[model samples]
Target: MKKLQFLSSLGFFLFGFLLFSNLKAQNSTSSSLYFPPLGEETWEKMPVNQTGWNQGKLGEFLAWMENTNTRALLILKDGKIVVEEYRGNRLTGLGPMNEGSIWYWASAGKTLTATLMGMAEEEKLLKRKDRTEKYLGKGWTSMSPKQEKAIRLIHHLTMTTGLNDQGVDLDDTDPSSLTFLAKPGTRWSYHNASYTLLKNVLESASGQSFETYFKEKIGDPIGMGGFWQRTGKNHVFYSNARSMARFGLLLLAQGQWDGNQIVTSDYIREMTSSSQGLNPSYGFLTWLNGKSSFKLPAIQREFEGPIVPSAPKDMYQAMGRNGQFLMVIPSENLVIVRMGAHSDTSLIPYRLIRDMWDRFAPVIE
Candidate 1:
């Protein structure tokens, strides 16, 4: 009977040990985020069943995306591809749009530029408080020396340069094109000329071409494939849908890639959060959702409530003209990328976010 009692206690001890080990493994798996291998086409996919999403609803959501002129759509959950589909043809009529096809990021590339600026700041290459004239030199804008000196890198990033955003080609970077409207920090407008000139700021401070600096600092590091294409005076970024998803993943990780701090966490926080009081929804070249109020691009009037009502309160986005979008929702460990032709002609298609979240919220919830 003593021998029997000893064997029973030993069995209970073994069972408890095994149970504890299993629980620890589960917790580790749940806490860790996946990172895809660099320079390879390999990306892990999380099965729909494993994601706890309604499969039927997801199908409907994808169908809705295709019907709305979507060429490529990628959704990542915890750094794993959950929904990836390439539908329709290229907007340029070059060929069918696929995973490898390149598309213009339009204004969505602004977020990328913003990331580079943050990285530059972290490297002691530039300071946000530095005047724009210091990089572009005096008479870069039509504004007087005093007015021009008042404009800072932060003002350009936040779109509060006080430059005349009306009655001129917003993309024109010529000194004559950039006329002063208000004192710096007094007004907020989506002045593309001011934003585009950041290319010069980046180039001047880093002592490297924008493309070279971008590839060395960001693109190559994160395994992203893209190049800055000159479209008239504007330099737009073009890349495959996967490249866009990779960027969103970097933002989701708060500028970390595979245990490397590519961009400082402090800069990332500032880039994603509200940059100024003028527009609560606008970040540093990024658009934030869930703000109390938001002002649309080129419009002075402010609207009530969050930009995307159906999305998570913590969601922010890199939105572009037409339908290009890179949305990051940290709260859900989710990153979504959509690239395609014009869904609408508005300078920034705010409605697409609303429609996407409306269909997307149901499946995830």
Candidate 2:
């Protein structure tokens, strides 16, 4: 009799647990916000912050780090700035930052280059299908037998020129800059030398320097103020949080500005889509945050997260050296930009997203 009673009690508890799980799944299924597909429209009204929402740990993070040296955090939904905060010291703490402060994009600038390549193609200045040597010519052809075959623009953009890590130490003009370590597009490696070579390719093909082409075309039209400034002898670019936000906005809009269609629709489609076989999650000059499962190189392991798995399967990102990140989630109609000389320089955005997403993602009607 006692065994029968025990079985009955156990059955009741199991039933309740299953019932609760079903209810939770139903709530999650009913959630309107989901992972975004490439080029899917997600433009939403600005200021996702609502009267009542759970910011969770994010509120505590901001409250504690008020005086820190983080540069700027700008969050926009449907093109209106929702969260704009500046902390820490500036260049001598002189001018206040608006949308005018220019931050060196580092490798994040690669996306700009990729987008320009697409624009140039649309204007007939360059063609993706054209062999790289069509312009670079015989001088560059003296590379290794394998290198000669591998010298395409696609190889440069994909970081698969098989150029070894030589440029990590080599100055731009070193003889090794022209060397190739593997056949083109067959390997997955990070080669700044291969990418730097692209500046030359664009110059030769477009008949304009990278700086000039972009300024005359995309930068000026978008109303973004930027300059490749010579800070001392080193040339770098700077723009404020708003400029970065606009850049993200252009991306999330799929290369359209005010319905003007800045970058061709086909190029935007390809930009967010993976090109090389090595990483299905990575696209041309862009890093994908979610997709079918794959292992990242050990260095990239730290930057990825279950965030991709749980957030959106179709999400992609543009990340820069030292953790500069531009995340465009079309499902959320969100373009988030974090620009900073992060205090530790580890490159993690840390609590900014932790707080913002938790606070703003509730989707209260």
lDDT per prediction? 0.89, 0.61
- Per-residue lDDT of 162-209 in model 1, one digit per residue for the tens? 998878999999999999899989898988878899999999999999
What are the runs in model 2 whose C-alpha is more than 4 Å off?
A: 1-58, 64-69, 91-98, 166-173, 229-236, 293-311, 343-365
Most lDDT-accurate candidate: 1
Provide the lDDT at 102 for model 2. 57
lDDT of 1 at 89: 73
lDDT of 2 by residue, 1-365 (tens): 99999999999999999988965653342232222222322334344355232455446545543544457777665565556777654545667654456566656667777888888888888776666777666556337554575467777667666655543442242344566556777777655545555666788888988789878777776766566554432334566666666778777766767656678656876888877766666678777655554334324233334335434545567665454667787765667776665444533343443444454344321
Query: Per the 3 Å backbone cut-off, how many clashing residue pairs does candidate 2 have?
Result: 6
